[model samples]
Target: MDAAQHISIYSSGNRQPDYSPLQSTLDRLKKRTEENKVTINHTNTVVMHFCTSSQAVAHPQLSVGAHSLQLVQSTRLLGVTVDDRLSWKQHVINIVRTASYKLYMLRRLKSLGTPAKELRDVYTAFTLPTLMYASPAWSSSLTLTQQQQVERTQKRACRIILGPAYDGYDNALTILSLPRLSERHREALGKFGRGLLCHPCHQHFLPPDAPPPRCATRHINKLVPIRAPKTDRYKNSAIPSIVHMINSV
Candidate 1:
């Protein structure tokens, strides 16, 4: 099985993040691969440096043996497009493009007099999954505009299904017994947040449970909130957003 590995180094107060440690780690990984008689797929190997700073900085020159790895502004890992800034804009664009193309196929099926029920099934089976894929990871990071871009695909699908009696996006969803994409995202995020609380491995990712209130306050069971994030991108990330959701509930 092939897997992508991420190595992160955080910057301290007012200090520039360093790449030397990352370079050393990659050197060791190359050595280990050679020792184990495993070949590195240099063509597929690339480096991405994530940062929210506006100041221009030097890109790390990373290598595996004699070959220098390519530095990409964005890359896809396990179907999620992650960019250097972690804004999730590119990821949303890619998924929207893909779901739109699938809708074209759905339009063809509709023209052939496919049953409304069957068309809905085709959508639920084929297209909805495309939009919801890995949604829990990036959904929290989406801007209002990006969220609408995603929801428009579903709205278009509803129009394709309902034809003349479409009425509106909301009524189409209600008539078809479908929830809004934003609602689905909230449910997905909530479910994922609850799962993290129970999951043995991922539970550690959450903040420690709040200590009991001295006077038995109503908010005794919430998880401690994390330190304030320096960037909005980090503030709206899956973990932080989910943590806030869990705490509120």
Candidate 2:
């Protein structure tokens, strides 16, 4: 599916302090739906996620019309599991667990005497995407443990394809001609930033034009810069860091 198909949002924050503004936002949404003759299934209740370090503040109950939404600590959006804290630990763990299972299948294929090239192709097709899916959007926020978890999966795949003899992570990867997981993630972020400038829908997110390039070769368009939000835990989790780097270049 296209990226736009996976977009998700909430009317407003679910915290007590946000109740007044949330109510107003909901009212506007309700009005727009009514005016557009759109139907909302009240049976499908809203789920709220609040990312907070403090456990002292209780989350207040919220409602849209008669439907009372459930407050959740984490929820799945698109294919990623997002925890309220934005740590992405759960998402990383989930993807790694899934990729591990695929690794087992790859091992079985290796036992069947699958050629190294075919095994590599199968791993790239089935397993690599799972570990790196939407990674550019989340990789920068990953803790070292999470990063290791992802890298371990790739390392295992490389071992499976190259056999137990080349068990060293670097050796297996070298035989496979695969870069480190961190390098792949960095490249993905760079490509994502470039893509933003190519897509019309994301143009508004770009900053103002850069000053004229010093050379004709550097005349390619540049992304606008956005300062990272001071309070955001996933400070570089999404667009800002990518755009920041692009603009700096």
Return the top candidate by TM-score. Answer: 1
Please write out the lDDT profile of model 2 over residues 85-134, one tens digit for every residue. 76788898899999998898888998999999899999999999998898
> Candidate 1, residue 88: CA error in Å?
1.1
| Residue 69 local lDDT, model 1 | 89
User: Tens digits of per-residue lDDT for model 1 on 94-140?
Assistant: 99999999998779998998877888899989999989998989998
TM-score of 1: 0.88
- C-alpha TM-score for every candidate: 0.88, 0.80
All models, RMSD in angstroms: 3.8, 4.2
lDDT of each: 0.83, 0.74
Off by over 4 Å in 1: 1-15, 210-221
How much is the lDDT of residue 233 in candidate 2?
56
Clashes (N, CA, C under 3 Å) per candidate: 0, 1
